[model samples]
Target: MDMKKYEVGESILFDIGQKILEAHWQDLLANTSLRFEKVLDVVTVHQQKQGIQNVRPKNLAPKAQQAYFQTGAGQTQHLITDFFTDSTKIYQQLKALDSILVRNLGPEQIIWPFSNRPQDLLADEPSVPPNEAAQLGVRLVLSDELLTQLFTTETAKQYPSFAAFKNAIYLHLAQNIISNLDILVYFFGAAPIAMPEASGVKRSAIQAKRFLNCNMFQDFDSYLLSLRKAASEPQPKLLQAPLFLRPQKGDLDYRQGVQYLDLQVLDIQPNVADGVFDYQVQFLKLFLLFNVVHTTDPEKLTTAAQRFYQVANEDPTQPSQARPRVTAYLQEMREFATKFFPKTDYQTALDKMTQVVANETQAPTAQLALEFAQSGLFQFGQQLAAKNQRILTGEPYQLRGYTDKSLEIQQFIGSAIELGLNYRFLDGTGEFLQLRSQQQSAIINARITAKNPLILQAILADQQAMNNLLGFAQVAVPKGFVATDLTVAKSLFHAEFEKSGVVIAPQNGPKTAQQVFTTPIDEHTFTTSFLEALDYDDTVVVKAFIPGSVYDFYILDQRILAILEQVPVNVVGDGQSDIESLIDQKNDDDRRGRLGQRPLVTIPKTAATAAFLAQHQQNYQTIPDRGEQVFLSAIADLAAGGDSFDVYEEVDQSYQKLVLRIAQTLNMQQGHVAMIIPNIYAPYQPQPNSAIVTDVAAAVSIIPYSFPFAGNQRKLSQVIIQSLFSNSAKERADD
Candidate 1:
């Protein structure tokens, strides 16, 4: 990157771009003898052609830049093939790192192209926040007014459509990207920089680091308002769960002053990783081992633990002959347990299990170990002192436990063993997609944990085997949930297994179909997408296309339009009603009996919090914070985790007819459902696992789009489900 002289109205902050490149790039080429000047010229040429016309070209010479890139697609290359043999592995690793960031926040979260002028911002101590609330160091840098101005009627008229206009405006603003928030994170956030000619670096989240799009927790004020509301409400509704909303704070210096087009930056401290990405890409059962990863000579730890258990159980004497490995494994297990929950009594759970295996020559020691690993109970029971330390980085999320479902997981394992289909979770999606490194994390309530003990043996194998071992679909392991299944998986699949699972057609339907009808401005026709088009707050029009076979399910009597919204009873308002009164009123009237929040059984610091809100202009009788509204308009079938009621029937026949017509317009097919989300039911509901930044340690559930692959969550069924469903699938004789 060349140091460019700015225009009369321009400024250049810190050369963060260079620093970013140094950290993520320099190492790969430091020892190489090749020159990178031509590569630099190409990059410079494109950069200038695109938008950066003001940059100085001298820094990007023909010689200094070619050390890494291979420019001119069809031109012959000089880079040696000797080092490229493991390029796939290297590429996969980089992708893994990128996936980690995206899984936590999002693919769009890392547009941190940053540049601070003359002074460095991160170097400052106790980073000054833009808001009065110092706790949540984040804020809204851009106003809704700006978006409106960019994509208003005038721009839409000129462009012929709103979507096209939006894209054009976004591009225009991005072309001239400049924000302190962007610069700040670009320098300090752990985003890797691009290597001049390295296409691989740009494969994942890290690649977009150069865009400088500013996806930080800039929407702090909104998040703060949401959090405070969550606190004031009786049931801190799941709608306002830590994930969907940003945390609250008290400092107030944040204002992206109207400098370049009055572009202001908001600032506030966050309680969580507001831009958290890639937490639930895969699910896995976890097992933590205290002893050596590999079995040792003399006797395995299980043998030792078995002897200890037998002595402790029977003789309580003559303990010298006990297996030492078992005792060691048990000690480590105890230490792990102590980390989360300390108990001075009965310190032999691990030891006893191992000892039982050791004393009985025919005992299934390996199978037992595999069981704990798959069930992940050991990981669950123990807590992490530091949330970032990962013992298992890439393991499959599967059913494991002492239940029927476990039998399924085990059966799956056994089938895998017999068929030898190379299976893994954190490896890659197209191949061993089920077992890739991106989703593996040994964290709390993880769908997939840090390590797959069953994989320990497989992973420790040679690299050739690891690379060739791809994932398969034409197979089902009914015993995937089995506790004592240790069938070594092979590299093949059964033909019948491939065709047995349910087939869900990818869902697709009408968008906000824009039709210029005369009634859009006058009649207020629900048949047109215009009702949803002009939506101002707390509303959404979910368009689903169900086949006729499922038609009755939609029109069920128990089906009320379930308004899954952020708890609206947030502000009772005025001075007449107390919080209890408001809570009672809301509970009595709302279809949902108890709010979708943890019960007020223990309000923690309820009184103090109320007093604090009173200090803010909010009255104790009235609600304060109002989080942005998000509603899930689903049928209230109870079984679908919704309440009961049928209010849709009360609407005028004309309205009902229009609703059905609108559904038809959106390709409703023969089966149409009635779960309408009127402005009345709109509430600011936050989605699950929204606490990306804050509650990294908490075991929050995963939402559909929020998770990596679609079916990545089914691996968490209880033990009984695993044992019965997983291990029982009939095996075919492909042998």
Candidate 2:
């Protein structure tokens, strides 16, 4: 488990079963009992035996016009349940099924499809009795009376009476089903066609909606009461519900809760090749986990279901058609998978699904749809089945570990290890490490002993002193005056404002910029912020507010190692959600986790956030129009939740030269320089510039230079270590 050696797109294998229909060319295979076997943790289909009795005409007919499928007398129809240990095994089983079908019924009789839509030939079939059709569709042959008797006997063992246990079971199932019905429908809804007059309903409904109605029951007792009422009432609404979890001899049972979920909503399409893809399996697991952790009122379930249906029914080939909420949910699921299956290639599957949702033409679904459109469905299925068969016996998948840290640190560590550099922990906590080469060993957290301690101390103790040192050396620095009191600070702010907009910051403190004000000088606001800065430090500095993006460059002696551009935290409104909701959504991103665990820090709901909102004449309840951008904070400090995008490659030569001159003037071996530039790519240099310098020891946070929010990441720590080795070698040569 060295996480450094782990691959990015790897995931663990799991054993799960997915339902699919058995077909020979265009004909369904009926009454087939599939047997499974396990050998060394790998499960496969051992045998497929035909049932002793054939499906009667009464059993094959549809109970209602909206039923999933309808068949004539003696028509063979069966659903295949494929059990697999992983995606590769699922592919193998699908290939085996294809071969078996082709061998038994000839190539012309072998049809591979993913949807469960009924055939057009069965449209004129006779109507079967509701009870008989229910039994046949789910293969639940046991009578309700017999099932009740058995379940009651089992329930009496665990409770005072069978009634109590049955109620509890119904309650559990009802809550889970009601809360998750919307997502379930979205995932499995495939039937989109229906006869209007026969069902007294116009258009088609999702497969899940074909049978189950949300208006049926309020709780466990009500569900049981409804069943009794349905048995006596002719043409009861409950008779047409899609899901069947009643007392039965099949997947579901009252005594056993839900042993299996029979989803009739899944549509059979040729593009899926096999029954489903690897991402579908991953999504199902995450979807179940999410349902278990979150709960919603049953009243809101219908609205959620309708929203999901609208999105699901849209042409997935268009990215713009995809709802933002659904896309956000998918991203959250991917993050959840990374936590649960850290050693698996689950992220790769999720990434592919994301691309599919985003309407990438290269995705499997879109690509297959194109092939189907170009060469017809049957030909596309045949070619895809052949291709799938070829890949069935490929190499077995190996799981690898996943790292949760920012990508830059991972790359730096990987590169360091590749270079054969030996590193040892400098502290027991493992925060500090000493990296060693033959010529020198560099301390990661303490890289400033090479510079004079007194000079570094003087500069860090006062911002004005540092500005004067840089200014005396003819290097550009912001013109500013210090005030020891609020009255003096206000006077200085007004004076600065007369010249231009003023910026107010604590003169002597670790995080002076955290509460800094970058607004036009006003008596009330300036006095307020000035007083706030005094709470942290004794003095405050008032200067002109520079308008540009802040850039931070790391310097080892005189050489620039890396540079980053600071981007303030902001949110884009979609018009549908309010500002508070948008902020919540942005904070929900995995990259914005607490501490330095992720690249970007989480946006905090603080007084500053409210103040920023008030300054813009807006509040948390305000609904910004679509495409509107709102800033959440004034200062662009990563510590205060601002984002940093790398600008190392885009740094102009003049900026680089300015950084080197600042480093040389400071007389430090290693340090950092912060500057403001109009354009990162532009060649213009700062004049009477607003910038600050931090000698290596005083620089508390240089990690931002390496792990920026956007642009190409730089291996800054590795660069620093390499510079140490180079400096040591040069010193030896001079000696």
Global lDDT scores for all candidate models: 0.23, 0.48
Most lDDT-accurate candidate: 2
Worst 10 residues of 2 by lDDT: 11-20
* Estimated TM-score for each candidate: 0.19, 0.42
**Global fold similarity of model 2 (TM-score):** 0.42
lDDT tens digits by residue: candidate 1, 1-735:
111222211111122123324334222212111110110111111211121212212211132232221223222111111111122322232233222222222211221111111011222332221111101111111223433443443323444443333333322222222211222221112211122321111111121222121221123233334445656878754331111211123322112211111111111101112211111000000011111111122213234333322332221111223346434544554564444224322243444444543554212212222232353311311222012212112212221111122222332322221221222323322211231112221121122222223443342232222222211211111111101111211001121112232111111111112121211122223213323433422222211121110111121112212112212013233345655444444445312222111111111224534543454444345532334211111121222222222233333344334333332332321112322223322331222221111000111122211111111222221221222222233222232
Runs of candidate 2 with Cα error greater than 4 angstroms are 1-416, 446-454, 485-491, 494-500, 508-513, 521-524, 680-682, 685-700
Give lDDT for model 1.
Answer: 0.23
lDDT (10s digit) by residue, model 2, range 1-735: 010111111201010000111111111111111211110000111121111222322212232321212233233323222332344433343333333222223222233332211222123552321111111121111122322433444223444444344444333334445545544444433232222222321112334234455555344444555666777997887765644445546412244433233323334333443445546644544454433323345555466455545544444344433346657767776665554445667677677667655654644334544455576433444465556443432211100011333333333333343344545445654445565655566655423323334677667567777778877877765667778877766666666665466666676654524454565546886788778777777878766666677788777767787787876777789988888898888888656765545557787877778888898898888889999988887677786678888878887777788778877776756767777776656675445443433222344354576566778666565566566667778888999
Error of 1 at 597 (Å): 9.3
